[model samples]
Target chain A: MADINAIAKQFTDFYYQTFDTNRAGLQNLYRESSMLTWEGAPIQSAAAITEKLTSLPFEKVQHKVTTLDAQPSNPAVASILVIVTGLLVVDDSPSPLQFSQAFQLIPEGSSYYVLNDIFRLNYG
Target chain B: MADINAIAKQFTDFYYQTFDTNRAGLQNLYRESSMLTWEGAPIQSAAAITEKLTSLPFEKVQHKVTTLDAQPSNPAVASILVIVTGLLVVDDSPSPLQFSQAFQLIPEGSSYYVLNDIFRLNYG
Candidate 1:
């Protein structure tokens, strides 16, 4: 049995760290087959995912994570479902946007990589 | 084939309307076997779920939905996965909290009811 909560917290911390500082480093988080549903649009592959991230309208952003939850897939699959909610400020916006993200992570060696990720902003 | 997008939008609108006005009416949204993961804790059964909802610390809440996305379970299962993100203001709070919620909706007759629901605030 894995300490899923600990892994989830660590991964989330590392994920947002990279997201806030080095968006380029996020390339290692996904693989060729990784899938991303970003704001209702689907993007796949590491190259495409990186492209999408780099193309976001906001040049600088900060993420404040509030909730982190994880659940292991039944039947003992290596993947875990992680849900995150947070506030995002883009380009020094006065009001931070609320965001929710979910990811399916597969363990590889001592670390885990995202298999499927979906992110959406809370308001229209 | 269902007009999934329309149904999703309509369901989201109705959901928030009831949430802000008549919290008691939320009971009809779930069934006996409905499951809820509220901020990381699991609550099962309609009575339990309702109890949890009514016990929320915030006396008055207003939800401003920013995103609503849905996908049907493959193999023609009657369930659809709905993901939502938004801002939630409780009482007269100055800074509204960010919230993310996901629901598994099962179609029953002409309507759909939540079978599994998970909600979490964005900040600790």
Candidate 2:
């Protein structure tokens, strides 16, 4: 059996690192069928997702993950649900914003890609 | 205009209070159509949900919410998506576990009910 926990942690670490350093590089992590509910709006397609990422209000951001949990879907499907809680600092903000993000990752080839993702900040 | 932020905060506060003091009171917050993906298993119906809640591994638990965010669904639907990050202390454990929970709440009468909920701990 694969070490799903370690894989989840590594994926989260790599995902956020790429998110901060190379936003465009995140392209490889999604497919055309991927769906994202960002804050409140639903966005589809890899291209549109990438567009939304590039248009984020913050110019610089850092994610400090405190908790990462993974659960594998039943019926032996090669999919996992990952939940994350972390603090995010955007553009040298004095106070870090708290965030909770969830991702449904599906296996493809040698790696996994996000099938569905939902993200929201803790406060308005 | 209703202050969605305040409403979200109040909802969260009320939720954890009920969860800690009176788990049975949570029955008012769910209906026959409610669905929950807890940890990794899929559970449906109010009766089953309550049964599962009563059978939790820990006897006592406390939730400390750090972040709560809400987004009303589009098309003027009386539905909102709520994301929460918090800590959970179970059974006198010295260390607390990190938790992330998401709920799709739909308005029915004077209050809202959970339509879909997902919860996961951030570790194995």
Which structure among the candidates has the greatest TM-score?
1
Off by over 4 Å in 2: B1-99, B102-124
Q: Locate the minimum summed-lDDT window of 10 residues in model 1 chain B.
A: B71-80
RMSD of each: 4.8, 7.5
Candidate 1, residues A24-119, lDDT tens digits: the string is 889899988677789889788889999999888878999998788775532234566678887898999989987788876877787788876789
lDDT of 1 at A73: 31
Per-candidate TM-scores read 0.66, 0.59
lDDT at residue B41 of model 2 (Cα atoms): 71
User: In candidate 1, which residue pairs clash?
Assistant: A66-B122, A66-B123, A122-B66, A122-B85, A122-B86, A123-B66, A124-B66
Error at B52, model 1, angstroms: 1.0
When summed lDDT is taken over every stretch of 10 residues in candidate 2 chain B, the lowest stretch is B71-80
Residue A53 lDDT in candidate 2:
92
Global lDDT scores for all candidate models:
0.78, 0.76
Q: Which candidate achieves the best lDDT against the true structure?
A: 1
Candidate 2 on A24-122: residue-level lDDT in tens? 888789888787778767787788999999889899999999766665532245666677778899999988887779776878888899876788776
Clashing pairs in model 2? A68-B122
